[model samples]
Target: MNFPTHIVAVAGLIINDDKKILLVKNPISGWEFPGGQVENGENLIEALKREIEEESGAIANIDSLVGVYSNVQSYMGWDGVSYTPTKVILDFIGRYVGGDLHTSDESIEVGWFEKENVLQIIENENLKDRARDMLEFHGKVIYRVYETKPVYSVKSERYI
Candidate 1:
């Protein structure tokens, strides 16, 4: 049996001195954590740092891995063809080190939001959940797999 290719991505839950979370508004995902697909030769931590810098212009130090989430859905690929792909995102808790706040080409806006406002500001439910999970993270890594589209269902979950 042939299996579909999966895209591995990394996200940073950067908390600043003001106790706010950094967020980026993307055309596709709305207000979410700053991150992107891992490039060739880049490990998860390297990709996370690069993505956070590229998307939010912020420097961060990854403290720990918060969780791993899998979202399987159909979307338009770079080739302009529709494909069902699994997006596996590794979320990490990061401490904001320094750098000016700026948005990249992939982001419409970049700003810090209070933890209480994340759910209301972020349009994606899954992303909101991820944020909440990261905020409440207690040194344990979470693993979650979801089947999206006709119905959003959790396939599996565990704490590691």
Candidate 2:
């Protein structure tokens, strides 16, 4: 028997005491929240925290799950040799607990931005959707399905 696998990833929308949102400037994804693919045996929350620290040098106190997004399209890897798996991203809302802002290999720039300005900062349409949901979270978790190849377009979205 064979089992199907999906690339599961986690991210945190971190807000500091001043109500500024944390963002990382990734070489590949541009200005987006800190997060990455879950490593083997790592729980979602743990992976989110690890990604936040690894990408932005900030410790976060995760508060709640904000949304779950499914990219139902498969795309070529950076090397252009093989197709990548479909991705399901779990996004969480959190508070910046401690640690000064710093950059890492995954993030060339890390800083806090006003919540209202996040959509303007993020270049990717899909990431903007995630950021928008995180900004407007009102005690509901959202589930969205989208495709990215031809253009970023939503297939479906609903509150969960």
Candidate 3:
């Protein structure tokens, strides 16, 4: 048995209402987006929908592509476990269409946080800035790649 490696993508759904961002506390990380590894045979849009729904128990309507980032900086190396970052993520702006808002075992807590109050909930400044960037695509989305080395790239998405 083997796990698929390349082309594996995860996604974070950014939902904002009245200038507040919806963020969830990951069971491992303090708080971040509700996302997971994209399984084989699933498209980007489908993976985003399933991940967000699974973690937050809410159905989100796809709004637009916000950005993509690496999950390397947030790896969990518990009990002296060696960690290697290996995930490419696509971030999107998902709007809450319907469904209950509750936290799953994958999360510790779930709720929306404002820019000013995001610090109290999420400790990662990088993620906070990314969250802010989600509001406005900045005319481009940040793409960081980590293979034999780390590379930073940018792309302009027609949607965001």
Highest TM-score scorer: 2
Q: Give lDDT tens digits, candidate 1, residues 1-160.
A: 9876889999989999999999999977789999889998899999999999999999999988999998977666657777757799999999999999998898999999998888799877778778878989998899998866666678889998
Backbone clash count, each prediction separately = 0, 0, 0
TM-score of each: 0.90, 0.97, 0.71
lDDT by residue (35-116, candidate 3, tens digit) is 6778888888898888888887778777666766654443434656765455666777777766777888887788876756
Model 1 vs. true fold: TM: 0.90
Estimate every model's Cα lDDT from 0 to 1: 0.88, 0.93, 0.65
Listing every candidate in turn, what is its Cα RMSD in Å to the true structure after a full C-alpha superposition? 2.0, 0.9, 5.2
Compose the digit string of candidate 2's lDDT tens values, residues 1-160: 8897689999989999999999999998799999999999999999999999989989999999999999999999888998888999999999999997899999999998988888999999999989889899999999999999879999999998
In model 3, the runs with Cα more than 4 Å from the true position are 1-4, 70-85, 145-160
Q: Rank the candidates by TM-score, best first.
A: 2, 1, 3
How many pairs in model 3 have backbone atoms within 3 A of each other, for residues 3 or more apart or on separate chains, i.e. clashes?
A: 0
Which candidate comes out best when scored by lDDT? 2
Ten residues in a row with the worst lDDT in model 3?
Answer: 151-160
